[model samples]
Target: MRIRGLTVTFGEKRVLDGFSLDLPDQGVTALSGPSGCGKTTLLRVLAGLQRPEAGRVEGLKPEEAVLLFQENRLFPWRTVEQHLTDVAALSGGMARRLALVRALALGAQGCRWLLLDEPFTGVDQRRAEGLMEAVRGLRVPVLLCAHESHTLSLADRVVPLEGPPLRRREGEGP
Candidate 1:
């Protein structure tokens, strides 16, 4: 997918300014950056959850993209499975794994892009690694934001970002 000169502003704060990126057709790509640097914003744009003030994203349909947010976003009233208990009953790691699995399934099922925001937050290293392997197995493009170096290391490419007006690190963008 291609994002070119994308601009997104919140009141007076320009979260993204002339930002651009090109993602591979398939494989794992990680976005590594500090908090509040607009990584989530960029992901939202790609997922069509957030509308940018300016710019264009090519080759990705919002409906064809599924985003697993930083939070589990499981409902307290609905059961994910087993029907007896709601999703909130699951432990943090379990919830994260479930969410990741769901996202991967959607992505693999004819979806074009999968966006994950900090998907391994509560999961242990071993399980996280296994989950990373699952992410690598998907045929569609995968763009994820992760803070851990170990997690980033698993990606085919890692793009470092910085800014309220977010941009790629020096020599990192095309």
Candidate 2:
């Protein structure tokens, strides 16, 4: 997706200012920054969960993308299989079981463009890698917010955010 002259504010804090980015049509892009740097806010804007005060975004369809928030957001009482069925509407039988397997492997399923926030949370390196592999298997655009360098490295391109005005660099380390 392409964003131009984007601005977002939360109360008195200007999370993003005059930010712009052009994402590739395919492949993963990693967003990295220190805490409270507006990376998550940017993702929300991109996902259409939050609105920007002023900006223009093109080439993204709201219905086709799925966002995985920083928190798991899984229903506390729902089993893993139930969660996938709830979101993707895959009922019992081979389809539901396959979706659950995919989600368990990648930690999410059925999203064309997966927006993952801190995907590695509460998981070991091996499990995280398994999840990452599942994400790779989807062969879709993946946007990730990451604190670890190794996790960021898995992305096709890494964008590092610094301060307000939301400067971005391609293939840079935070």
Candidate 3:
């Protein structure tokens, strides 16, 4: 998807000012920046949770995308298996491999673009790496925001933000 001259503001402060970006139709693009650089805002806009003040976004829709927030929204009372079963209803009952379950049934939800915010939080680095590899293997495109070096490494491209964004850090080839 492509965002052209997107702008967002709150009160007197500006969050995204004529901000723009182009996310790939396939593979992963990691949005990297400091604590308050509008990464989450951009994700929200892509997920239809927020509307931009100006410009246009193309190539994706609300139904075509899913945004995984920085916090784990899983029900604490539910077991991992239970959560997996619940998700299976969305992902077409894809078989289980390892326990890395976040990306499990999202595909079945018809989510073409997986937008994640610090998806590996609380997970160990080793496990996070494995799960990221699995996500990379999926045919669907991915757009995520993270600061971890490992997560950044997993992306097919990295959009390093400094203000209005900058050039993309091309990953080690697709």
Best by lDDT: 1
* CA displacement after TM-score superposition, residue 99 of candidate 1 (Å): 1.3
Better of 1 and 3 by TM-score: 1
Best model number under TM-score: 1
Which lDDT tens digits does candidate 3 get at residues 11-39?
Answer: 76677787766667888888887877788
Using all chains and alpha carbons, the TM-scores for the candidates as numbered come to: 0.91, 0.79, 0.80
User: Considering only N, C-alpha and C atoms within 3 Å, which residue pairs clash in candidate 1?
Assistant: none
Note the residue pairs that clash in candidate 3.
91-108
Model 1 weakest 10-residue run by lDDT = 79-88
Off by more than 4 A, model 1: 82-87, 171-174
Question: What are the per-residue Cα lDDT tens digits for candidate 2 across 1-174?
Answer: 888888998778888888878887778888888877888888798778998999888877656676667755445566656765665333333332344344444433455577777667555566566767777778888888888887776778888877654666445644
Q: Indicate the TM-score of model 1.
A: 0.91
lDDT tens string, model 1, 1-174? 889999999999999999988888888899999999999999999889999989999999899898999987776555667322231478888888888887776777778888999999888889999998887777777899999987888888899998888988778745
TM-score, structure 3 vs. true: 0.80
Q: Who is ahead in TM-score, 1 or 2?
A: 1
Global lDDT of model 2: 0.70
